[model samples]
Target chain A: MKKIGVLVGVCLSALLLASCGTSGSTSSSGSKAKGSYQTTGTANSGEYKGIITNGRYRTSKSRGVGVSQNTENMLNLKSFESGLTTISKDHFSPKSYVFQEGQILSKGTVENWLGRKSKDNPEGLNPKDNGKKDANKRNPIYVQQIEEQDYMKEENGKLHLAGITIGIGMNRKDYYQKEEYGATYTTDIPKEQMIAEGKKAAAKVLARLRSYNAVGSSMPIVIAMYQQAPNDSLVGGTFYATTVSNSGTQMGTWKATDLKNYVFPVTDTDTVPSKNDADSFDNFKNKIQNFFPNLAGVTAQAQYDGDSLQGLNVTITTQFYSETEITSFTQYVAKAAQTYLPSGIKVDIQIQGSDGSVQSFVARDNGDKGFYTHVFSSY
Target chain B: MKKIGVLVGVCLSALLLASCGTSGSTSSSGSKAKGSYQTTGTANSGEYKGIITNGRYRTSKSRGVGVSQNTENMLNLKSFESGLTTISKDHFSPKSYVFQEGQILSKGTVENWLGRKSKDNPEGLNPKDNGKKDANKRNPIYVQQIEEQDYMKEENGKLHLAGITIGIGMNRKDYYQKEEYGATYTTDIPKEQMIAEGKKAAAKVLARLRSYNAVGSSMPIVIAMYQQAPNDSLVGGTFYATTVSNSGTQMGTWKATDLKNYVFPVTDTDTVPSKNDADSFDNFKNKIQNFFPNLAGVTAQAQYDGDSLQGLNVTITTQFYSETEITSFTQYVAKAAQTYLPSGIKVDIQIQGSDGSVQSFVARDNGDKGFYTHVFSSY
Candidate 1:
């Protein structure tokens, strides 16, 4: 209740100064605002809690246009954000908390934090630039972007900021040029070094966030470190590890999430972590490919927790357009998925045309007895 | 701009009274707002001009959660909204106008308009109820929803409401029951009758809009009529016709857009308007299907302007996952699209996995010499 008073006071003053103009704060009656906002809540977790947002769309203060160069990179960023929230829910119960987009860190503050620590920008999280043209000597941008997601608890009718989760998107490979229009050079940051740098950066972010009066002193901060996939990767990277600091700026010991993603029917045997998962996917792929002669390609992104398969997302490219054909094919796919796929895991299959329009969908949640199928009706 | 002064005055007054809390008015500096807002702009039209929004996401006043019952219904609603914007470009040049989501119609007003006319609700646009339970005697609700898009022109850095486009989504098939939770019955509305009812509703909407002080007199208004597709249909309905009222509340004659969409390889000969288009699509499909043996499906959605082909959206579902195979197949697809498909029309092809993840993209703009292709890189 006291925090609400302070937030309202800050908002009232900001409104008068016209400084925080439409910052999407709690002062706004959410129902009156425009545009639909949705939570990427999972059904298995009993739904992600409260809508702290005004149900209005608000662009991130920094990188409103987005920094992802392509679709693959974009997916990587999305997965990192959503995956972090999932991890946070284990510590911060969704049933007891309200979800809100990061608002504590101002655009100027975040921009400064993402930059290389220089004489002017002392608050920068990345290593100070050496101003060297050589790839080996030059300091790469280890921390690409810092994302904050605020968690709140409702007291009375108002929501109070209770927790903060920070997602650090660290670059695995840095691409840069020595001079303007010069030949580009690539610097591959070792995974160990990236992890170390990411943790250090997160600690700084936590300290900075704690300095803000809005973030209570005893607030638990969750830090998720993600290794970004290369720009050309078809699949995005996954959150490898996370840490939580219950109080002050010091973080707890890092806990290995052991989450990994792989393209199914992986050509390279060395990269396949689990032989069982690979064999299962191969069987599923063979069954589907044999079932339909006109099949174009069957590929999947299989997610794993250590050696155990967690979920599989499969796409079946087809040449069929008729509703009857799609319907029959979808039924066959559901059967194949149930029979061939690894049991005790969530499997989602999509049958699409060459144009990428989904013709049918077959899905089975974890522990489900059978897959549910739906074929799109052609008008 | 006097409009700026008026809007600022209105916003300031609302702020003082704590009434319009974060209405997302022009008074707020857009760069400071939260969440991304995007225009459904097309490339051919030079680009839908102006960022009239604060770039913050705002939900629709009436149906923020949306009224679409399923995925099919959602797509229908989306296509209807986007198609209306595309049609609007013809009358209102995108280069000269700034697009903003409908904001003038308050939530209460739209709710009343969507309701059936009764003794309590006189402002209701639908027909009055006679308290009859019979299907034939009972009055079916015709108008489902009204969408308003404001077009603005900049003068001295501030945007002014120069024009407005109203989209009327009319029900083609009304499903209802005599009593609550009773046996449902369907009422099929003829195309002629739907159009008449849509136009009648548009006239009323225009009249009401004219009464608003924010909407300047002598402003041009474009009204588009969209027939809602049946709930089961995969594809959404298109905008059949549109009319423009250059001045005052009087509308002009309706002009047929002549745009129609069809699923490729049509088995129903009567529905296939152009024999040449069907032959071309068949040839194209055959070439791609023959090029690859493991293809799941190759389907296309072709849009026609009268009898002439306008654009083609093709989806090729594949079983191949190898980078080399996808690249080689994409090249063949590009060649097949160019050699077999109809010329002088834009075509877009997507090679995707059974999970619907896009693997490769092949496209050719109108009057292009060759198709451009890109295969997604495997990580």
Candidate 2:
């Protein structure tokens, strides 16, 4: 009984150290309040215990903390994080598993893996440098970033790392400046090569994770492959494929994700696969343009899986000052959206005045009839 | 009795048209939900009924929508809006007034007001164009943008526009490109002149507001002057002065708001007025840097109201992949912040890994002994 009590104490301390090691002042996790499992202090009243985050945010091991403020990379960053979280839901159900940030992968290990294969860093996953300055000859940095998320489950009143989701962000283009503060040049990587390289990188990451004693061979892992947008693109990239290894060090059979993202009123006809979606968006745009003659521009970004549209994010730029005018215009937009745009897809519309502050927004959930609208007041 | 009823019906229709004309679907304002006055659908349990926005966002009348993605003006944009809002709190208390977007000033009027004063546009507030292409002689568009916010009060079971706050954003430097996709040149405006011009413009704006029947002589107006940061600045501008004119169109006594914003680890000694505050930040930064050897940079944006510091927003850039390291480091940061920084000020610290994603944050309110830290997990 004494030996058993000591072992239990060790496990409990380890759990506490992992969850609240930052300040050690926050409320403890798995402190059952009534019937529900309580975790973080975040207000959550549901069956699924809210994510017990360690307060560590994810950053790309290679990119430094953030890109330049001027870069259009923020869009890609948002998609990469949110899209990975969405993919995590498929394997790690929020109802059964509690979300925790991946704590096992140390900073040193991730940094080494992101670096180009070198003599000193033999574990590097990226292609080795060949001492060539030419864009065509030089190998691009195929694997840009890796993000890991761990799902926890309570067993014997203690949270256990049940499942892990890994997101590998692959670059579609490699940008390099010849000199400091000089003009930037780009080298494009073929889509097929990027996908192939991503899968290989994912497998290597999996193998490395398995080497850790905590993450044994039996641990279930889900690896999602993301193709990042080019540096100049306004919209972000999407996940191309994903694989789920139920219980092994080896990766499972790859499943191609038909997910795609396209800016509406696409300038290039070849970029958009669906002409019907383009036409539908055009109708919506035209309706809005016709209503407001002095509109600066009306643009939308649509996401699709296979042929059907999954979501649409629209931005309308116009000159507005009055409450009555905004209200009347918003009503017109809602009516136009319902009549012209494709239904059965989640849609969000943001109306920004010439000054760029959000004037109003119209949002509709998937399969919803009525649209929800809100106007922001400056006062 | 018949004439009185007709007049009441007209007034009621006008009120409805002003408030809920957008969709006429959401709940009406001043419905009085139990003990509170309900406005929008947003959940608000405070005495303030919340803002009754008309659903129109503010954009720069001159700039047109958002600036280029690469420009560092977003920092300035945030300060201009939030700073103005903060200034408004002094005059328009949430307990008595409901916030609303400006309604009387039409888009055409604002657009015209932002243009250069000429024979065709007599009401233009900006200096008339001299038809000079030379940067030295050309009249700069000193009046960059204008934001108007209305504060409403409940009277006789109806909302009335009682107060108005106008934020006049003046440019410190005017950037002009000779040709499309060409080299950009800047013409700097002297600080003394910018302030003088802003005050002059404020009086003009006041006179215009008085012309409107809804905003007549009795309506109180607060106009705050903002000296915008240059195009290349990492930090934003600050509100230099503000004047509140009560019950008349004439300008009131201008009060110099000594509110200033500065980037810490000061490279230029002349910029920071208080030397002790600078040394305090250095001590705090050094403590964290000494503890962690590998850090990209540690910087803070400190806002000071006169000689006293109001708030500190610090960002620490480093490489982090593990939750344990983040937790440990966050604890150290919290300790360092408490020990080294100013005691009676709100401080927020965000730690970002090399890749640019936030690892964790440590925040402490004024007069608080302990800090609140949150770690965001990928899962």
The model with the greatest lDDT is 2
Expressed as tens digits, the lDDT of each residue in A152-237 for candidate 1 is 77666566788888888888888888889888788889989998888788877888888989886689999888888787765678
Estimate, for each residue in B1-379, the C-alpha lDDT of model 1 and write its tens digit: 9999999998886574353223312222222223333222221343343331332222234433223322336656555665666777777787887565566887688878878888888889899988777666777778876777777666665666788888887888877878798887877888888888888888888888888888756888898887777776555676778888877788899987767777788886448677767866776676566443454578887777788777787888865522323444565566557656777787878787667776667777777867755443322
Q: Please, what is the whole-model Cα lDDT of each candidate in the order they appear?
A: 0.66, 0.69
Off by over 4 Å in 1: A1-45, A50-72, A179-183, B1-379
* Model 1 chain A: ten consecutive residues of lowest lDDT: A24-33
In terms of docking quality, model 2 is incorrect
Query: Count of backbone clashes for each model?
Result: 51, 25
